[model samples]
Target: MQKRATFRNLWLASAFIAPQLLLVFVFFYWPTAQAAYWAVTLEPAFGGGNQFVGLENFRAVFADANYWASVGASLLFAVGCTAVAVGAALVLALFADRGLRGHRLYRFTFFLPYAVPAAAVGLTFRFIFSPDAGLLAGINHVVPGLWNPALDGNDAFVLVLLGQSWKMIGYNFVFLLAALQNLPRTTIEAAAMDGAGVLRRMWDLQVPLLTPTLFFLLMVNITDSFVDSFALIDVTTHGGPARATMLMVYKIYLDGFESKDYSLAAAQSMVLMALIIGLTVIQFRVVERRVHYR
Candidate 1:
């Protein structure tokens, strides 16, 4: 009787999960499998002649100078956006975690940008940085070329990094703020009673407990920056000013869909997937053990 009851419960659970499992298989696994298959082959000739050219697509990727440049630019963009966004968010979260007047209003103000669509954010930033007759240009009158983020390669790179970071800061802050708000107050009070200054308590007590949340946010922010910034890049600069901000996803978009080189795009995408997977693995291996929560 117990065995029958257990089997019935398992069946009920499977029934409830079936739709989600099927959706994952259809949407995620199927497309991933197709991309992986295409990454190993050249575009097949029409009329019933297709050859499996193993690893040639990836070989071409390695041999292409433009591909390497795009990869480097992508790495730079990801690191820059992640560092700035996460650092700024961490600071904001820590400051706001304290009981300040109008804290709710301040939280809303910071999180407002996260609600803006990425395309809109990019377009808005472009207008702000336009050479003349823009809000930033008006500010530049007093600040002197402060909005010239597109004048050259270096300037363009800086503009994209800052724009992306600004868009991401709110999202990162929300996560860190939740972590901080949920932290145990007893330990913080105890530390304060022990005559620990804010910095000392943060360094010795709070940060140790916050490490897991910080690591998780860092991983997610980096991955999202790499994968989702394609739309922002496309709308803002189109990887412009001589490929200065031509990141990996933008390259994949141009190569696969725009240039219609599906094989090359798939290969590039596989490389990105590998990089993200490796980073996630490292996060678990090295960072997870150090996380402390009481």
Candidate 2:
């Protein structure tokens, strides 16, 4: 006979979960509902009142070329950071999994970045990168203005990309390493016994098994790229060097806080939300097909 566990005090169970539900509603749903309302309404800079203006805000946002630029930049970041972070993490995780000499130290060091806040990582990289007196300054001291991010928009963007990718790598590495450690050792041993070399075994055995983890990381990295980048960009570039790294999320901040255009900001935020949702749906529908879950 089998027994099913049940909560005798339904009120107690509900009470235990009430805090989490309240937090979700307060943080996520409330803000989302407010954004939805403000997106279609115009609000004056000095806070007169919210005025319902329908989709006029969206129309203005679409008409602005700067908004489109932010969109393009966000997409570029989403793809670039994911590819760089995931690939770099895979390499580090593989090396760590081999348990080579000093691997314990290596594992600990590799994961340190994940422990640091993104804002802190951004600050550290900014100190190391900025044009005044950092790594770039030292390089320019010899090269003579070869890679000044302050003067070069492309250079600034590259810095943001590098910093963002570096921050994401530690997070990806932790999960990838855990997944690698759990994979069946018998499969790897059999492949080696069959005369498969290291690369062959990795390609034929390890990588396929790693697909599910890779897919999950891909989704997470992409989603995080769009949302979590605000703090990094704000600290490092402030979406500047002539708006070169102006991502969609940052654009919303500029519109609302800096420019005092709440309605337009809300509209931009809605668009950003839609973009994230659309990408998530596509990833699940298309990308998940290739994920081998076994």
lDDT of 1 by residue, 1-294 (tens): 246444558778989999999999999999988899889877665635445889999999999999898888988888898899989988888888886897898788887788888888888877777767666678677878765656567767877788888988999888888988888899999999999998788778877777787887788878888888877887878887788888998999999888898888999989999999998997887564654422
Give the lDDT of residue 22 in candidate 2. 100
Which numbered prediction scores highest in lDDT against the true structure? 2
Model 2 bad stretches (over 4 Å): 1-3, 44-49, 279-294
State how far residue 176 of model 1 sits from its true place (Å): 1.5
Candidate 2 residue 174 C-alpha distance from true site, Å: 0.9
Instruction: Return the TM-score for each candidate structure.
Output: 0.87, 0.89
Computed on alpha carbons, the lDDT of every model, listed in order, comes to 0.83, 0.86
User: CA shift at 110, candidate 1, in angstroms?
Assistant: 2.0
> Residue 164 in model 2: shift from native, Å?
1.3
The 10-residue segment with the lowest total lDDT in model 1: 285-294
